[model samples]
Target: MTRYWPRFNRAGFEESVAPIDYLEWYIPRLEELRAHNLSFSGMQYNWNVLDLLGDTIADIAKPYMGDVDDPKEIIAAREGVNIENVLITNGATQGINIALLTAIAKIRNKSNGKITVAVESPTYAPIPQSALILADDVIRVNRYPPKDYGHWRINYEEWSAALKKSDILMITPISNPSGWFFHKDDLAWIIDQAKISNVTIIADEAYNDAYREIDDYCSIHSVAPNSISINSLTKVYAMGHIRFGWIVSDSETIAIARRIFMTFSGVMSSPAMRIGTKVLQQSSIVDEAIADYRSKNLPKLRSVFAKHGIVWNEPLSGVFGCFELPNGIHSELFADHYCKVNDLLVVPGTMFSDSMQNWVRVAWSIDPKSFELAVDALDRSLELALNQKQVNKSK
Candidate 1:
């Protein structure tokens, strides 16, 4: 038998998926903990639905039962854009994937030599990971660690220079793992550079609404002609199970990306479409969900992170933040250590960026009671991690 590696930079994503989900395959050693609600690992805000709008489970149960309802109207209203500008996707990830593939197709058809995707470094892993998998070429621009929470901006000059060398820029508005969103002027600077370089900016705003209380985030779709915004119900709406998301942009990009989406599955599931549209039309439900999460969980998480000496930028608009763990502990190791010993599962920063190896992303979104329990367990876990480090050194 012959064997070949995938060549895509999916190894890190593959390795971390199972552990991050707290499944039994790799963490057989922590079977009991696996069953517990100790998750701080995932980015989704798990919340209770305030209403049951489903007419019947059977009606929307199968894909064929749901009518040909388009999410364009609802999304257009939500994003304040024209109906033709929105294309519904199965999820934000799929939206991102199709967008990338569309760009690849366009660039390849132009007979442009292999295109380069410039990803801001220390970003959501999948931005670069997916780019590398699709384009097989990526130019990374580094973002230095902020000494404190208030200063989370990256150098505009450095980022623009990297943008000049690429055909596509896959960036996150409110970063996953990090929770650090860009300032308004910095976002404008990026858009200006993209226009100058003729690079398509894929602005991922998955976590945009998480900080609505603090900063009213403006999507680049309103400001930049060359930018596309992909967002999902997975994060802020606390509706991850719906698998609903959409891309907002000009007609040309939507036409190409829509064709790519059709090639993938033709249409989204009936239940997903029905539920997704309903959710978007109803803003009160979404608002209440996030408000509940903030009121119930933020204070405890803030206390827990501070007490553990975990330094992180206060998330401007999301429930999770990339956290710098104290010295004498590594992300992958501490993530495992914290999970097994304290049932507090976290995703290590290595999953996001190579430079973030010592960091771990902790979510403020989780089952509120479980999140509280995880916070209670933090001190003991940090102490245990330190003690274990000492033992390893002695060996």
Candidate 2:
């Protein structure tokens, strides 16, 4: 038997965070704190359905009992375009997997076995992992680091060239670690390039609603009808437990994706689907949740980053904000020190990709106080790291 060292950079620090343990450890403490009028470590607000929605969850769940065949009901209810354009899945992760599998099947059918995928650098880990596991050849194009730390720029020529020889292109709006979203014009150009190259585009908009302002957000589905847009109820809704997500695309793509899903996961749990339908139907509930998060927590996050002199891009939308350390400490080591000594958890940018070594992602979804405490912990950690570097240099 041989032990396999994990090649993915962030896995070790993530393991240290013990996400499952964090949930278990935090949930009970959160519940107990609720009794004392203290906030918990998640972003969802405590508003009643009546406060956010005119309809009840039960009312929303009543109409979709038959077979889940009509994608229109889900789409229309969620205010998306049409039925031919949507495929509901277990979550965004599942939608991404399905998209990759669908892309693989399409390319393999066309190329007789050779299938290649092009991805943006500093991309979400799952994109590369899925491409490696499912596609034949993978090429990664790198995005430029932001000049001001708050703004990011992508090289169009590099991205366009990569798509030319690839069968599929994977991208995320409001990238996971950087929270840097592409401009609508830039996104449009990319979509047009894909159309010309005859490549399938997979747009992961998992943080779709996390934009700083709703009007600034644009969906790639509008730009390219053929592209698959994947979204979830996790980040904005703070409903990670719901595990609901969907892919929007053309009918042919939906049919193939559904077939792949049926053969793979059979059907999503009935209860999750029921809750998901309820959640989606209440548009006001979603809006209110986003508003509450932005109004109450975003400022705290901004102030903390300011206090530490940590440079970061203000997230256009989503629970995550990316910041660069002042002293350029290795992300993994910095994050590990924060967690081990202070019980503060953060996702290292390295988890996203090697290009993100100087940055780290902080989830704004945590309680306001927890965020402040984490910032304080980070303050101490940064000083200690700087001191250690100085000592090493002196020696």
Candidate 3:
């Protein structure tokens, strides 16, 4: 047997951080709280892990031993068109990987068998990174400004031109780092172009339930019947601990994805699949989780950012909100400094894409009190970074 490091694209080089813990970087603060000490800095908030796992586990574990041929409960819960359209996996990350491999396999025999995946500029890192792993080339289309951030706006002409050359197009309905919901009209146009160009659209709707209004959000799967939709229980259900996700598309796509899954990993554990099924079937639990995020946590996050003079695209839905930092502070360095010195953590805009270097992503799905602490820490961190930069320039 030979040992080889996995080849990763540029996006792969960035380290992965749990979205919740990433914001509360201070371990000592947490320890103090555990010891029943009152803290001034406010770093102790986190998602109720027990609430997420305890409620869903029994349902998830049931399908494994039961006589059910298909997880009807989970299938109906997702509102998927049919059982054939759904393929469960470890998480949305797994769904993305499967989608890429399936796309490559389908196009491997074509003239330019090498797939070109087009992604939105300032897109989620995994989109381009996954494409690079599975395709010959990756093209990026910028949808928002890099420096002073704003809403996601697609340049239809640019997208259409790229569509001609691309074999796959990846988008997040409610984007990760941006928290910008795609306009229905833009999504419709993209679908039309994809159909004409023979490009497979992979819509990562991991944050699907995070929208402010559920009605306003449109799944790419809805517009492009052939498009592959990827979703997970992590964001919407606050069940990241369960590590369950699924892919939805036409029957053919699901079959191919299943074959690839068998070849890659003999079988997904019965446990994960069962748990996923359980979460999907429990509609009330899912709805309650969504409501908690929408009504309570989101408003608190928006006010905190506004109070600090930070602006973001008011996410119509999703767990995250993206904000731009004041001038002279690099997002990566600022994030690193904040985490290390101030016990606060945030994803640098650079992690999302090169064009997002000046931005930072804040996950608001955390406890509201913890979110407040994170916001306060962020305010102080930004001021320190700015002041330090000015002092250096004077020298």
Candidate 4:
């Protein structure tokens, strides 16, 4: 008997599905820290926006029993895709999970070798972690460092090589830490490579909706028919409570994903789909608020970072970016110290990748005045941390 590498090995699942360390570190600081919550990577939810939904609380609650309208139809009409191509899920996380499950199922049948998944470094934790469980092997395709720090651009050679061996490439279209959207030519090149290799590109597009103004903005599934694009209201629309997201791909892929989804979740939440429909119709309100926040707060954020001698990627559209720490201080150490001493919150980049230990992710999605206070607090925290490091050296 020949020993071929097994697909979705039970022992592999045990080792691969560890806790998402970032969420573990972040949730405590997020709840306990009362002042200056810079860790808000999403637009701060505007409580009053619910009143503008054009539905009474009682009317919205009706869907808890079940929704009459098909969510796939709603999203298809909005995204200009066919109903067959859409699969509604609880959130972007579930969309990604379903996509991976589908990808592995599709690849394992065809491949003689172990299935490999390639993910970007400095990424949102779940992308790589989820990939680890579903694939036989997971490899990092660096998105930073080879390029200068803070600047994000994919190296074509590395990606092309990875695509040859990989069954799935999990990417964030607009990167989480750096907020860098792919260059048009680069994206096209990647699609071509995936097409040639028959590798699936599962794009986590949670932040893509934020930059509709950008001319190059189009869902990956639309361009690369075999690829999948997943999006949600969690980050860009400031509607995390709704738990609404969807996947766009070819009809066949969507069908496969739906089956996998049903195995895990018997049905989608009716209430979430109903509220999500209203929110989609009312998205302009959130977009306008985001624009207002950016206009009033971006300059202040830029000014404060410059004052503190901190350099950042300077995001093109979104309100967040990755910052390189001064004097090569460890980001995890500084983030913990910052929260404890100053009651502030910032995400340490170590959560994204071990290589990113010297970097931190910061967001200015709060109101202008509140953001101003947070940046000032950040400045003071930086000085104190630096001074403390110096004191330790003297001892």
Candidate 5:
């Protein structure tokens, strides 16, 4: 496996250091500590947007259940895929789990044997954790940027070797933390290799909406017959509370995913489905808000990182990006110090990969004013840490 499960609990279940756990621990304390949250990777929620959708609320609030638009059909129409290729779920979290399970099932059904999985390093925790739990074997593939903080890409030789022995490949089109969108040539090459290797590809496209206009081809599931793409309203549309998400793939792959989903979650949330349908129809409202925030906050984010002499990945259009922390300052330790002393929250890169212990992920999805305050806090915190490092070195 790319990483081992931290340790087994008393119940004999494995636990890992995932972003969700840290967020769950930190969120309730955010307001108490008056912390400036730079860790929120999703778009800021807007109540006014919901207020304008009064009809949508009224329709979903009907006491009795009635006929409603199918979220699957809506997604199918939008993606130009057949209805059979779509499967709705609670959110991207569930979508990923179902996709992995479905991939395992398909492999087992074909060979009636064990399967190996290849996962990219510095990936979202759940992808590797789930693979470790479900697959017969697991291996890591390098997906990293050069020392100069250039565009991130995979080690082709390593990836090719891993794919030959792998039954499934898990990837994030717009990678988390790093915010590196796969280059067109790289993506096309991966698809071809997976086809030759008979490996199923599961793409987590949660951040892809930001680049939809520029690269609609980011949804690999729509182009590769053996691949599956998962996305949700949580990250892009600020509708995470609604718990709406979907998966796209070939009919056979989707059928397997549907069964896996059904086995765990009996049915889709009725209200979420109804609300999500309308949300998709009026996504432009949320899109406008996202664009506005990016326009104002992205520049500020770049400026703050440059001011502090941090090496940032510098993504063009995503809420989050990774940056290397000052020399000798561990990300986990610095992040905790930053939060407790400076009242700022930034995600430690160790949560995603052991190699990223000196990195952190910062998001610019909040209001410009709040983002400004958060970045200022980051500046003070960085200076304090660097100064401390200098004093220690002198000793």
Candidate 6:
């Protein structure tokens, strides 16, 4: 057990927000603070503290089944794919790890135990960290910069150039933290180019299954045979506690993935799998209920954000949106102090990208009253941050 992962065992790991060490150090501290906290650093929308689903999945002892109504089957059918391609996993993070590790296994011998990965920058930190651990090189193709919602394109020239060289293309479509939607047409072109270059594709579509969309977006698996799609119930479904996710790919790809998976996770969680099945069975009711909650409260939150001059892109799909910290406060510094003083949290965008040091992600997934309370707390933190900037400036 020599810790077989792609994490760099070098110095200066604490500096960047996207590195693995930062997340490992930061998350547990957040939990400890939450004894008296009201954090917005969440992925889901509209959850009640009390049990809502009534104990329906408590009796699962066997492996889950059904190419229909089963959680894996439900996701497969909804996405219009086959059950054989669906992989029921513990969480989207696990799904990502499996996808990357399986792909790495194939390239290890040929590339001398390493491969090149091209990841969309400003992505969820885990994406590149995992890739960095598994690949020889992880080239970051910066996505569209923040505050500009009109054009959310990758630099085609940069992306295509990288696609030609990379052995794997890993991306978070309708990503976490930013909720930036990669246009389906652009995705198609990328997938096609990846195919020509013989690169395997993994679309981490965890949020797409959660949020509402303006322009319909499809996962790359639908258009490419070599592509894998990952998703979960943690976000839009308000099922974070359940910790269920899955991967979808063609039979050959999934076959290899299943082999790698057996070495780690022996079997999917029966109870969570059952609950996932339950969620999918009732998806229409559940999805609409959460969407309706957002429809009611998001406008109020937007008004508050505008009043404070906090600018953000309206999320096209997920519950999270990145906001520029007013008065040029570095996001990591603001996050630490914001928690100490406010008893609440906003994830620093630096955790996703160092380039996003001036921004923080805001979540509006809680009930309106709780959201209002978080906003009120933010009201105080915002004022102090602004005033502090002036005090330092005048000195």
Instruction: Per model, state how many residue pairs clash.
Output: 4, 7, 10, 0, 0, 1
lDDT of 4 by residue, 275-373 (tens): 777777778888888899889988887887777766656867887888778777888778878555777788887767777778788888898888888
Residue ranges of candidate 3 with Cα displaced over 4 Å: 1-73, 145-150, 298-300, 386-395
lDDT (10s digit) by residue, model 5, range 165-252: 9999988888887887887778888999999999999999988887776653458886676989999999998889989999999998
Clashing pairs in 5: none
> What would the TM-scores of all predictions be?
0.83, 0.79, 0.78, 0.89, 0.89, 0.85
Query: Superposing all C-alpha atoms, what RMSD in Å does each candidate have to the true structure?
Result: 4.9, 6.2, 6.6, 5.1, 3.6, 4.6
Candidate 6 lDDT, 1-395, residue by residue in tens: 11211232223454443346446636775776542233343434444323434554344655655522566667778889788888888888889999998888776777755588888877766787877665668877877753455436777899999988889998887865677777667777887789889888888887777644466667768877788888887766767677888899887778888888888988777667766666667667656655765786678767867777777578765466777877779876776686548766777776666667787777776666776777777677777788888899999
Across 116-182, the per-residue lDDT of candidate 1 in tens digits comes to 8888766655567678667746787766767876536778778877887789988877765577777
Query: Per-residue lDDT for 212-248 in model 3, tens only?
Result: 3556566666668668888877767655666778788
In candidate 2, how many Å is residue 170 off? 0.8
Measured on C-alpha atoms, candidate 4 has an lDDT of 0.78
Q: Which ten residues in a row have the lowest lDDT in candidate 4?
A: 1-10
| Alpha carbon lDDT at 109, candidate 2 | 71
Better of 1 and 2 by TM-score: 1
lDDT by residue (1-395, candidate 2, tens digit) is 21111122234443332122223333443444321211222345443445433544545445455733443476644536767667778888888899989877766778757888887777655666666667666788776666674446668888887888888888887776666787666677888888999988898888776563655477776677567888877666656686788888777888899899899998777556766655666545666655665677677667766766666677666566677776668766775563435545555566555566767676656556555665566556666766776787799
Off by over 4 Å in 5: 1-33, 48-66, 215-217
Candidate 4 local Cα displacement, residue 295, angstroms: 0.5
- Lowest lDDT sum, 10 consecutive residues, model 2, at 1-10
Q: Model 3, poorest ten-residue lDDT window?
A: 35-44
